[model samples]
Target: MSLKAQLQDEQKAAMRAKDKQRLGTLRMLMAAVKQREVDERIELDDEQVLAIIVKQVKQRKDAAEQFIAAERQDLADVELAEITVLEEFLPKPLSEEEISELISAAISQSGAAGMQDMGKVMGVLKPQVQGRADMGAISAAVRKQLA
Candidate 1:
């Protein structure tokens, strides 16, 4: 099934199961997806849906970090929980070893000799790593390799 259809099915199941937290998160996701469709006037494919989910997950993580920094454990926990919900639809994450290998290949493929070629390295790597690893971590790995 398409990710969007899977989400809608899960949303219905969550409602039937009275899973308030899951229901709320799914609703938020659906709203975001619907908003994007309406704004763009085009239906999103699975990849686009995955991209939206990844964006939501990032937002939750950032919010959780901000909450923690502000000493609001309860809010941080809530954000983290939402992140877990959002991540259910994401592809399994790449291991660090796998990411390192891929980064090395990208560097070699792009002939990125130093930090100056960071953009070239990333351009070669981003599509392969998107939604599977954090871009910040990828960039750091690229820097470490270049340095």
Candidate 2:
């Protein structure tokens, strides 16, 4: 089944199980997905949905950080919980060794000779790593390799 279908199934389960938090989070997710589809006037595929999910996860993390800094642990915990639910739908995170290998391959494929070619390498790496690895970590790896 597709990601959208999976989300629908989870939504039903959440409803049946009386999982208020899960249901609310899933509904918010569906809203975001539907919003994008409506705005763009096209149905989203798994890849597009994944992009939306990634964006939502990032927003949650940022909110959690802000909440923590403000000494509101309760709000921060909620954001963290939402992140856990959102991540369940994402692909398995890439291990360090796998990321390193991909970076090396990207660098070589892009013929990146130094820092000047960082963009080219990153351009090649982004699509392969999207939703799988943190772009910040990937950038650091690419920088280290170039150095």
Candidate 3:
């Protein structure tokens, strides 16, 4: 099933199970997806939906970090819970070894000999790693390889 359909099914299940937290999180995600579709005037494919989920997870992580720094454990916990729910829709994460290999391959494919070609390397890596790896980490790995 498409990711969006899977999300809808999960949302229905959450509703039937009376899983308030899960239901709320799914609703929030659906709203974000709908908002993006309306804004862009195009139906989002699975990759686009995954991108949205990834962005939401990143936002929640940043919020959780800020909440922790502010000593708001309750808020941070909520953010963390939301992150857990969002991550259910993401692909399995790549291992560090796998990510390193991907970076090496991307660099070679792009002929990225130096930091100046970081964009080329990232362009080659992003589609393959999206939703499966953290882009920031991937960029850092690419940077290290280039350097």
- Which scores better on TM-score, 1 or 3? 3
lDDT of 2: 0.95
**Whole-model lDDT per candidate:** 0.95, 0.95, 0.95
Candidate 2 local lDDT, 3-39, one digit each (tens): 9999999999999999999999999999999999999
Across 1-147, the per-residue lDDT of candidate 3 in tens digits comes to 999999999999999999999999999999999999999999999999999999999999999999999999999999999999999899999999999999999889999889999999999999999999988888888898899
- Top candidate (TM-score): 3
Give the residue spans of candidate 2 off by over 4 A.
none
lDDT of 1 at 77: 95
Clashes, model 1 = 0
Tens digit per residue, CA lDDT, model 1, 3-95: 999999999999999999999999999999999999999999988999999999999989999999999999999999999999999989999
